[model samples]
Target chain A: MWSRRTLRQREELIAYLLVSPWVIGFLAFILGPMLTSLGLSFTETDLFTLEFIGFENYTKLLSFDATRTLFWTTLYNTAYYVFLSIPLTISVGFFIAILLNQNISAQPTYRVVYYLPAVIPGIAASLLWLWLFQPEFGLINWALSLFGIEGPRWLFDRKTAKMALVIMSVWGAGSNMLIFLAGLQGIPTELYEAATIDGAGIWRRFRNITIPMISPTLFFVVVTQIIWSSQVFTNVYVMTEGKGGPANATMMMVLYLYRVAFREYRMGYASAYAWIFFLILLVFTLILFRSSKAWVYYETEIGGQRS
Target chain B: MSGAAIGVGTARTSVKRARRTQVFLIHTLLIAGGIIVMIPLAWMLSTSLKPPHQITKFPPIWIPDPFVWSNYVRAVTIFPVSFLVFVRNSMYMSLMITLGTVLSNAIVAFAFARLSFRGSRVLFFIVLSTMMLPQQVTMIPLFILFSRIGWINSYNPLIVPHFFANAYFVFLLRQFYTTIPRELDDAARIDGCGVIGLFLRILLPLSKPALGITAIFAFTWSWNEFLGPLIYLSRMETYPLAIALSFLRAAHGVLWSELMVVSFIAMLPPVLLFFVAQKHYIQGIVITGVKG
Candidate 1:
């Protein structure tokens, strides 16, 4: 049908055709919703009617009065979770990766055991942990008894709820371990050999050769974990029975936004909450990206091509 | 000379002994860590088989003395909506979404990777940047959009968005496509294979591992998704396994054994996938840094 058209034009047309679905979806799903959400933030609605509320929703959420809203509590709770979970999970994952990177027998079997928990569906894992964390009869407390230490009320106690979640998140650090392991394996063995010949001990070789080489991987894990963990909802929702409670101790921003939007049907208020949450995430990600240059080492830079 | 050689030999043997001890210590630590990691899962299995009497005991039973295999049956049939319905709903949605994800991502990625059209670079950058936008920002509007279109309680809302191609998968596939040599495309075109022909015959056929990775990621993502199903499907009958398993606790009063049985059932597909196609699964995960 396009025989008369030049080959280049035909190629361009075909390219557009191939990509149109994604472009259309991006506009319809992502861009359009983003704009509509922004518009919705300015108006109060309940799915039936809309009233222009201006910036009331934002101000209410960001207000100093913690009594009027649970926004601060949710933010604080989420921050607590994010800040604590990231470093712990990263360190644990990196440590495991270093262990697995050693030339050892039954390596694949060890890897499978570690990665198994990471693949369990979130809901199932949450359910499993809920049972495991039962204060009286749970295996955790039972094990604690064996060590002659009394176990604290985990998810049931507000003071320990966030800590319980941090512990659970660390269990699923197998993927991070795998990523770090890949990075570890990628380090040329010759570097370690040369260092050893120069009388560099294990710690010296690890610091000088290993750490710099995998700095990029470490940076990647941190960034992704930040973005992902900040939106943590399923585990908290399922375990806490969608309440984030034991005095709202585990109430994350997304869960709070969910309640406001779906439960209360406070569309405008929820949209505002959503936007605020988005900006906070954006700031964190931006800061991480900016800071990455100082730490994230790339071999390509020395090769004179910055990819 | 003999005395010096003997000294060197002694030093070498001592070094080897130290290395052996190091390996032994590493193995010991690995075993200890592995047991710690496996405990939760082992307990889940134990809990699923335990009788009601054994479940709430002070010291948790490591093994169920009277193993109640009937918990699985009770779990499935005791619910108002049978667990089978939830399984069917989950499988249908997961399969459809996986199909959509694989097909859409591969085609769009092909365009960006193989064709050097005007503005493709800019468009791909937009695709990548979208990854940073949190889902919560769009959640409300999307809920409104789907509700306005009368799509709630149906699989349409859960499955349709995947057909458009997600940015992360597109980026992954595009990366995969570029690693294939351009010479094949050139040779195909010289033989009068058009653009579509090249993609189908030359590219798609050879991109099995990449596509397999994409399919596995999509299937697992769909299988394990919680928030989407939670928001979209409100009715018990329409609920996927994730939603259904969560509700089991709320609806049934501490039916721990039954709940475990259902949770185990819900976890089976993805866990089995990981076991069966572990290399591809791990590769897919590592490639995109996507995790459960």
Candidate 2:
């Protein structure tokens, strides 16, 4: 028989062997590019030149004539989108999951209907939404006429364009709702029975039992949703043609970064923008993690404590 | 307990009626929401079938007068390149990604879950953290790297990355592998099974659910990937359905009729796969979040 030390060494070697591919890929593809982008952010780069300019790109983004306005506008648009979509998505998802969780007929059929959009490609879904939002001949306006409420030009009008994106986002809310439903199902039936024995109504049971049980999943959905919404690009790119237009109303940061990098070939400046956006997300995520202790519940532990 | 407190139970009758009405209202609201959610998709199908003039007609034709089967045929022909090429390329690349990711990630996940080693926890955490890094931050440098490697203008950038294993899939599979009984491994080891044998003979057979889930996710993600293929593959011959569809949109200049037909065709693979694996996909999404 092999010695314990030799067996342990063999196991370790196998572990390393198994994971070597990921390690190499991460170093060559992910780590190398990530560090290069960070370094590039501090430099001034153009089509013909690149130099270490020491915060020049940052300063330009903050105070330069045109860049500053673009930066702030993109930030505003992203912030507005993240704020509106996160709550709306979570609430809608949770409510739908609750209804689906009930002992209702055709539950499977309802689930498939809700989740159909979530499975479709983002580009296809965005294209479908674009047609739905057409101003003159769109079905939305047609439906509105029956109620005698004239719909505004959705994608054309600046005020309604962002709202239109938000509306489009709701179609795919089924993914998050599925998560919430799973979380809801995971809550023990005993807990509900106990709450009922204590004379708790449905609202009280939900408030005291269901919410705490699902808080961790809720936190996960919220954090990821915020991160995703802040980086929204594909829809805006396909729908608006990277214009951020109808007077720059829908110009998200990632869309702006695409225009900078690909369209204008301002690689270094775009790198800086990318890093700044990363920093904002990193900071916000850290804050969310810090605050999670207050809300997130660990089932294995009592007192609703964080793990 | 409340049964004893309600001696005047006619009030309870009215309250029960009120609760029933409230339940009815909630169901009504849910049905309305479902319809609103479905309207855009419904309209896409409707407009795609409408004739050219009826597409933009006033007060819009909600349903086509005669479903124009010809529009789909025209959409297939309108793009200069064959749609079949895009479909074949997309299927091949997506299948490669799915197979590569499942095999590589399952091996790594088996290691992480069943094996004991120093620094394993830290390394696993690092893998998880990588998922948080947005792809945009690395897109430029990755492009430069691929260009230098002569992997650009081909499917290498898209397919080869799967060999390394994605962080999300790795983490998911690890969780799944951990749930298998350790006694199985112990028993297999006593029968002279090496680590690889244990993995192949014992664990792999039992991990069908996770493998299925991973493959489905990999297929869907690869199929939907637009930005990666758009940047890397320059030649028209190398384009996927997503790139092909975008080109169709650009060529037609947002011709609603053509765009609708092309979009529906583009949506087919994922929609079909979703219906096939609906139960598993929904279960995967739910369980990942709830368990984590």
Candidate 3:
């Protein structure tokens, strides 16, 4: 039999060996690139050589109109998107979940139909939406026309492109809808019964018991939605026909960073833009985390098993 | 729940009538919403079968007349890239990446879950934090590193990173691993099962569902991945369904019939996966299959 000391050492060695892939990944892909990105921000790289030019790339944002303008427009577009998509998606999803939780028939069919949009590939979804949002001949405008309402030129008109993007995003909110469904299922029905016994109407039961119980899922959805919304690239990339166009109206931060790094070959400048974007996300996430204490309810803290 | 779960047992006649209306209203609203949500997908299929001219018809033909089955052939042939090539590359890459991710993530997750080593908790937290870091943050530098090593146009760029455990998958698998009681480990240990034996014998067998979920996730992600392949694989031969669909989109911008055919082709696998694994799919989503 193996000695206890040797056995412990072997287990430790095996542990390191098992997790070594992550250690390597973290160093090579994550931590290494993170620091390299910071370093690359201060240096220019043209695939062969890196030239250290200290804060010049950062300064270019303020000094150069094109770069500064691109930054501002992308920032505005993304901020607007994140601001609109998160609340809209969550509220819609939560509302749908509550409806699904109702004692309605054909629940599975309803669930499948609701979640179908969430599974469609972004490119395909974009193509489908592009057709629908067409100024003419598309289903959306055609439908609107029947009601005597003229539809805006979506994905084409600069004014409505960002709105179109947000709307498309909200359509795919079924992922959060699924989560909210699970959260609703997890909520004890006994609480609803108790509330109803106390003469609470449906609205009051939802307000007092349901919302507080599902606050953690809300927090989860909000945080994840923010991250996903901020990284909106594929739909915009395809919808704008790879230009982020209509006078840069739909240029999200990631898309702009992409144009800088790959298209323009301003790797250093792109790195600076990336770092600033990261800081913005970091700050927002921190703020949300700090604010979570006031709203996010932990079942474990209130004596339930789940943490 | 109000009547059944409570001691009230049954509602009065008026209340029951109101409840009937409420239920009817709920079903009506849900069915309406479902129809609205399904319209785009329905239109995609509708357009796929439509003849070229009918695509832009003002009335928007709901069904194709004489159903142009040739649209599929033209859609596949019109592209400089082969649809088969895209599927093959996608399958190869997705399978390899899935195998790599599921195995790597499971192994690493096992260590984090069962192996109490120095820095394990901190490293696990590192895994969780990586889930928060957006791919946009690392993409450029990773591309540079890959291109430097000439992995730019190959499966290596796509597949190699996955051999290193993914943060989200590791977290998911680790969560699964923890749910397995420790007494199983003690029971196995009495029979002289080593650390590897405990994982391979006890945990691995108990984790078929978790592994299934992880493989499904990894496959769907790599299959649906566009930007990575778009950046790395510039060669037409290496294109996945996602990028190839983009090429057809870019080329024949108004060819709605062809676009729909290709779009339907592009959509088949993930949709099929959802249908085939409907139960597992819902379970994965509910169990927090880390939002992509």
**Against the unseen true structure, what C-alpha lDDT does each candidate score?**
0.87, 0.82, 0.83
After superposition, the stretches of candidate 3 with alpha carbons farther than 4 Å from their true spots are A62-69, A302-307, B1-15
The model with the greatest DockQ is 3
Candidate 2 per-residue lDDT, tens place, B110-150, comes to 88898887888998888988877888898777776777788
Per residue, candidate 2 scores C-alpha lDDT tens digits across A164-257 of: 8998887788877777877777777789999899899999988888888889889999888877778888788788866888889999998888
Which tens-of-lDDT digit does each residue in A1-307 have in candidate 1?
4464578798999999999999999998999998899999999999999999899988888898988789999999999999999998889888987887776667777778888887789999998888888898888899999999999999999999999999999888887887787677778778899999999999998888888888988987888888899999999998898899999999999999889999999999999899889899899889999998877888777752322
What are the DockQ scores of the candidates, in order?
0.42, 0.38, 0.48
TM-score of chain A of each: 0.95, 0.95, 0.94
- What is model 3's DockQ versus the real complex? 0.48
Displacement of the residue B263 alpha carbon in candidate 3, Å: 0.7
> Which residue pairs clash within candidate 2?
none
Q: Sorted by TM-score, highest first, which candidate order results? A: 1, 3, 2
Give a tens-digit lDDT track for model 3, residues B101-142: 998999999999999899998988889888888877777788
lDDT of 1 by residue, B145-222 (tens): 999999999999889999999998998898788888999999998898999999999999989999998888789889
Give the higher-lDDT candidate: 1 or 2.
Answer: 1
